[model samples]
Target: MVAIELKIGSFKAEYAGKMNLYLSLLDRFERGENENQSIGIILCADKDHLDVEIALQDINKPIGVAEYQLLLSKEELQTLVVNEIKASTKEEG
Candidate 1:
């Protein structure tokens, strides 16, 4: 299996913990379930690309790193919340 490593950028350690929440994320990027193994590293803030490069000195594996961003508007947030409640109400009905 090709071992894969994931480096995720986060605002804080709390958010970095979400890395575990996506344990299955790399499965799709993989060529096949038996063809690769995945690993992940959560960075609270990576100021430079070089920083991560240095941090992974001895590790030799197929790796990937990405930054996540969120954008929300007041109306969009409210609409989503209302829609969720409506969906639940329908379930109960």
Candidate 2:
């Protein structure tokens, strides 16, 4: 099983905003220090790109928006991509 960090601040934030934040955090988390097989989000009232920056102004950690699930890890996705590329190359060749 995977882990998720859900952050909620307001209602307007919605799930879409949370997903975007998840992707952004995932990128950072992948390189930064942390356990694998876990995900996060950053919730807020609005997601104006700048809003997210401000909301995450001075905070950091395995955080998520709201209504969460155990999403796959970056390494897992990368491995899948590499495998797909290899398979495609082999098929073409």
Show the lowest summed lDDT stretch of 10 residues, model 1: 1-10
Q: Would you estimate the TM-scores of all the predictions?
A: 0.35, 0.28
Candidate 2 has an lDDT of 0.51
Model 1, which residues run further than 4 Å from truth?
A: 1-34, 39-47, 73-93
lDDT of each: 0.49, 0.51
Tens-digit per-residue lDDT, 6-84, candidate 2: 4434423344445545556556566445545344444343345654455444544444444333256768868988999
After superposing candidate 2, which stretches have Cα over 4 Å from the reference?
1-70
Question: Model 2: how far is 49 from its true place, Å?
Answer: 7.6
lDDT string, candidate 1, 34-92, tens digits:
65555554433243456545544544543344554435676887899899999999999
In angstroms, the error of model 2 at 68 is: 11
Which 10-residue span in candidate 2 carries the lowest summed lDDT? 1-10
Clashes of each: 0, 7
